[model samples]
Target: MSGGRAEGPRNIAIVGPYLSGKTSLLESILFATGAVDRKGGVNQGNTVGDGSAEAREKQMSVEVNAATTVYLGDEFTFLDCPGSIEFIQEAANALVGVDAAVLVCEADPAKATALQPWLKLLDELDLPRFIFVNKVDRASGDVQTVTEALQAVSQKPLILRQLPIVKDEIITGYVDLVQGRTYVYRESGPSELIEAEGDVADALGEARFAMLEQLADFDDHLMEELLEDIEPEKAEIFRDLTDNMQAGNIVSVLIGAAERESGVRRLLKALRHEVPGHGTAAARAGVDPASKETVAQVLKTYHTQHGGKLSLVRLWSGSIAEGDVLNGDRVGSLGQLMGQQFNKLDRATAGQVATLGRMEGIVTGDVLTGGGEAPELRRAPRFAPVFALALNVENRNDEVKLSGALAKLMEEDPSLSVEQNESTRQMLLWGQGDQHLKVAVARLKSKYGVSVETEKPKVPYKEAIRKGVTQHARHKKQSGGHGQFGDVTVEIKPLPRGSGFQFGDSITGGVVPKQYIPAVEAGVREYLSHGPLGFEVVDLAVTLTDGKYHAVDSSEQAFKTAGRMAMAEGLPQCDPVLLEPILQVQVMVPNEHTASVNNLISGRRGQILGFDAREGWPGWDRVSAYLPQAEVGDLIVELRSLTQGVGTFTFEFDRLQEVTGRAAEQAMANAAA
Candidate 1:
């Protein structure tokens, strides 16, 4: 999208970890902006941001929700993103179409690591973002400690703009570092301005100086003023803060209790006065501000119960009307979403997040143009699916309907993937984590009218012989018309692992007819399908040695029966064994937890190769290991738990290894069951 319509409206994303008060903040902002007369609470199941049935049922956001409001005569749209890591793709898709992000986080030091993933993402995008320390009123520790923890995980310097005012160990107010003024928070309405003295004044001086020092690092003039002991003006401080933040050189910090509506107005004012316009964001995204092309990016896609397909797009340049054709598809409708409510519009302006109706082929992260080819915009990185579930249709007749519904769900959520396993013959739904797949399953029933039974995917195991065996077998059948007779001898040998199955003939003197020999080989291959262990047999070779046939009764079918009988009787004598697939796994985590991860891998019958510092990630390590496919089913779940929810891993099939002991016994028993 081009940046020609840079002044239309600003889109901001509200992002953070789970239970960080983002939905509550969105509700308060909407209420303060007069978009809604009353505020909605997440616990009350009335929040405007998370209006979905699943979200309300769980009291957590499952996807990104958009709400628009007018603040200080400027129109703004806030994309409320889910806090759970499983749903991070929803935030990643929405962030690309926004001008800035407000990271809502709790005032707990222990939760600092949770912000690393979000900060790393914003840093990669070079998107200007501010940290909003929510629930300051309930903070158990000092705000400085919280900010310090946050700064440790953040790449950019954090400019503390405000300090919480504590009285009787409870936060009652805050001091604006720029304004050098203390304000007492009220139960309702704006914080009341108050005078500061003694310790309060002294603390404010130090905090303000600290903020100015950070800003001065980016502004030479401010640095000179500070060196010369000349106090900078409030306007000058604000100018530096805005410039540094918009330049992605500094991350500004604000504090508030969103549930009580405290600090909400101040947060809104900072966004209004400091957030760069959409034009700057468009330019940062590599779109030309002067181009006349009507370019937009699809931030989200939805399939409503009655409205068909709707694609939420951010109009980066130019305007689009209801009848305009985009990508050769007619714009059947145009509208905006405020929670679950839809406001119909005939046209949408630039820099606006609007919904295009009936955009059937459109998907999240798609770059759309009015005509011709659309410019290539940087797309969000797709996270590898770390968890999966085997789904079985509850009703046999719903299988066809289930496939169509899954396609629609996958369209809405790109992070989810579906695959039909050929070996196991099960439909597997893969996602970022268990919770992520669970939500997708819930949507299947709630949104698409499909009910499926879910279970852990079965391990695809195979069997092979440990030794060679030579056997001869004869098939004789007597019928009313004639008697059939065929005989053959074959040698079965074990090949090296991964050699697969091989068939050949060493017959001499025409002991077995060529036509009957072909039938014997086919029978042997078919018998190997279900070996003595009831699994596909691999890595073996069979040679046709000799056979006898009666000219009058010998037939291909008789030879085939003779070949099958030979294998069924001789394979048991070859000492058959089971084999399980192995995978090469690489676990990434902070160095502090490397040891824990190593132990975790060993406990699951994994062979740890080694670990080294993770490339491009400071203080992190990548541990490589070889684990059986069966051990990897819940590896991610335990890995995340061990690393405080920050660890991740990737795995691929390496080779098939022989399985023995109780593990093998259990696998065989389970297969028999």
Candidate 2:
């Protein structure tokens, strides 16, 4: 490393909204740095970022792609993260190990709303970041407006470092605010340095002064120099920029179009001079900097076709080599990963990200130490699933393999989960969105060789009685010398809303024997499993007022049959109703979209409890409502669409409420079918 900086690679994550050209930026960075012989295009499906078959088929990033390059004698690893909100977990997981992030965005002000979530996440991590307003060549508006729009969503001040040079209403080049020089774009390679004249020459001073003013907010020396109207030395100004950026005090903004490889070298130079080293990331992740132990945290996990499992990890404190025992598992191999390619490493030191092979028991976000003690490292937060699908194995022989395949998928991606719904009798796969679950299914088929059928998960509906009834029934059979006889009289009544199922007996002393009472209760419970409404019965009480048992032939099986007969005869007489699970939901969104969320809940036949400003979150609101489970299946998709993909919610089962009309009719029809 130069200038006395620590010797290690600078890990940076390229993140933004969908189609913001993050993968394109990685390709350009690699090509510009000579790490790759030629740049690859996203549409051509030859880029190192989206190399997976699933990503190529969808023409979008489905996971995090790591590529390494060198610029100006400093090593850098660029993690090209998926930009779609559906795959945001990939970015969240990768960011914990990175030194900083480059947030790429379009120049359109209308799309500024999409940057809020990414900004909020970066602020939470307190990671240094820079904004690259991409596609300036295609922008139809002024670059200042785009900078202002970005500033509105970011918590840190956005200091614009470049001024676009516009000609005939099209952006042709940019003036470096720091260097006080102008450059013209070269379509195939690095931009050409040019002399500033006319409009560019006149506008350079004001823009540069404005950038220095923002930087001075956190630097006392710069503030004094600005106050005295004295120009600061260029080296001093660069020092202030690097110091503030590494401290997370300000965000440096630059302009570029990654598809054309414009400004990529300039971007790399900025990174080389300003980006914090892996030491800063290790300290930020709560790793003990003074400790000499070998600690590494798994950032991502992948189960390869023929290579078993490979865990991408960031070594925090010491070096590790192949065959080292980490967290009770032997490290089979160690290497650096570039997309699908692996470069074998003799040893990996602290602050370097490496891939460990065959870490079978290890998972994403797991902290491993070769010293046998696990370090407490910061882990990525697990997102609550917002979408679900019920799976059916296409081949009966694959049924035994589904669980193992799903286990691997969940291991590779902590955001994915699987559940067995006892009431609905369906195996449900839960994820962030419909596309998220779809990609998971594709992986199961392609990667694991397990074909499956998927459908929307069935809501677990229940049944409750509206009234009470008295009924009597008997079971008698005469096949041989002894006959089976069981007679009973039961009083069935509806209880309170959440009383569940209650069973009691008030039989006279000699009429029914004591041994037969539990059998009768068991019989009642067995019948309740499927009520007249074709659902598990709940919120009702049953009393066995009287019963007759033949001394010779009466049995628990006979009494159970008698109880089932009585329920089949009595429940229809009482007004049977469908009861659906109601969830207590708290929907959190930006205050600007609060009104839309209220209307959304009402349209879904929900009851709004109240709404208030969410604590600790400024300019956001939490709306509390009671929503039916059936209506909640696709609520997240609509909520995100309404709030620019920033809205989310948490829910729990509150109670079972009676449902009628078309919703109840549909539930009944589905049950019958």
Candidate 3:
């Protein structure tokens, strides 16, 4: 590891959409800072931040990876977050503890548009951001065109820090606008300042003037000097840009080919010179559980194979040390994380990330402050499970072990949820997408030595009446000592949708007597809970008009039998209908793929509620639709495949729609079988 004097670390997270080369950029930064001997590539599966097995296998980051590097004698701790939306919450959590963000973007116009949400998030966080236009070496588009496309999606003023010089589609080097100097990369791997002449000088001068103009907006003196044609000092320009950035008034855009390490060194140098570190320790106000004192936030929790549990924490105020007991809002064990492992640190100071080991009763979003007060931390990102699957242990005897393994998996990824439907008796695992669940199951086997089978989860369906019917049922039995006799006349009527089930006793006094009335209602409820169609019965009412009971053998059992028999006989006569659940879904995809998504939704018997272009998203739109739950089982898989893994959606249970014709017959047949 590289060593440097710690003077208030500047924690910055690198974030963007997937395949925008975020991990590659991080690797280049690590190499440029001399923290690593050589840069690692994603394809080679040797990058530091993309170290997880799942990430390596998928050639994409699956979690947040942190490391520290020194640039220009300043220490900077960087977090490289996964780009897939399935793991986007990881990036959002990292955002909580960071001071700023470096938003990486691809040169493609469409890819640049996909970064709008990330840019908007940074804007909302009010953190100064720098746009790194990566993959310049392989870009076929013009730099100016890409910049314009980016500007369309960004609300902040985008100030160009560097201008690329192209020769036959090759980015030879970049001209530093702030320094008014041009550097071309030589075979030796270091940039060399080259003298410009003629048209080249004019073009460079024009670009320099544009950058100077942007900086001048932050300083009246510079603006006046520019109007007077008086030259401004290079140091003054740098100061203005840095000040504007810190104030969140300007966002600097830099161009580079991170894979080739072309302008990576310059980018790092700029970060060190421009980005400011934390100023002072102050008590960050947070809700206190024990008392009313303020507290700090817990940003990350890691479960390592060798390191145990580590809670990467950021102290907002006061002081914390080893053995200093702290309580979390939610009950859990607390521990500090260290480099894929955790150790109990004796103590940690404010504004520092420390690993606390084996801490009981702690969680990721818990606060620890003075006076034994612990408050709930900020809300974590919540993405509804858009896809689900029923899972069963391959070996029947391993059921409990499989459940335990899944619990561990859930602990690692809070986005995942597991539940067993009582009516269907299906063990379901829900996640953001197919890949998300696939990875979860893989982890279950690899980490816990548990194996399981997965299939499309069954939709929780119901059977309801469309019309009313009246029927009579009787039960009579005679045994040696006693005789059983019961009879009932009941009217079953269809209730309005969502009214649920209701039972009423309208019988006259002394008819069946009030004693056995409760028994009849209970029986009706039991049968409704599992409807005549073999599913739960809903949206109906049953009323008891009259009944008879034998004086010697009348009992609750006899009445229950008569009630159930009456319901069984009257339900089939009332025109039962199978109701399937529908889900309201919002799908986000590239504009080019929007039509395809609409067609796919229609094919699934979905109704499009319409679509609108998303704000600040240049080439994307959000499509609103309602689809049958059954059709959405693998919708995410098909969507990702269609959009090259750039599409995502969120959905929730909407309402029940009646299945009709052949579909209803098939469902009923399957239920009966």
For each candidate, the alpha-carbon lDDT, in order, equals 0.89, 0.88, 0.76
User: Which candidate wins on TM-score?
Assistant: 2
Candidate topping lDDT: 1
**TM-scores for the candidates:** 0.96, 0.97, 0.88
Error in Å for residue 400 of model 3: 4.5
The clash count of every prediction, one per candidate, is 0, 0, 16
Candidate 1: lDDT over CA atoms?
0.89
- By TM-score, the better pick of 1 and 2 is 2
Stretches of model 3 off by over 4 angstroms after superposition: 1-7, 186-189, 197-199, 280-295, 318-320, 328-347, 370-381, 395-408, 419-423, 477-485, 551-553, 584-600, 610-626, 635-654, 669-673
Poorly placed runs, candidate 2 (over 4 Å): 1-6, 615-618
lDDT, candidate 3, 131-187, per-residue tens: 899988788687778888888778777898787887776889888888888889763
lDDT for each residue of candidate 1 in 463-486, tens digit (9 for 90 to 100) = 999999999999999886778898
lDDT of 2: 0.88
Name model 1 segments beyond 4 Å from true: 1-6, 482-486, 515-518, 550-556
Q: What is the lDDT for 622 in model 3? A: 96
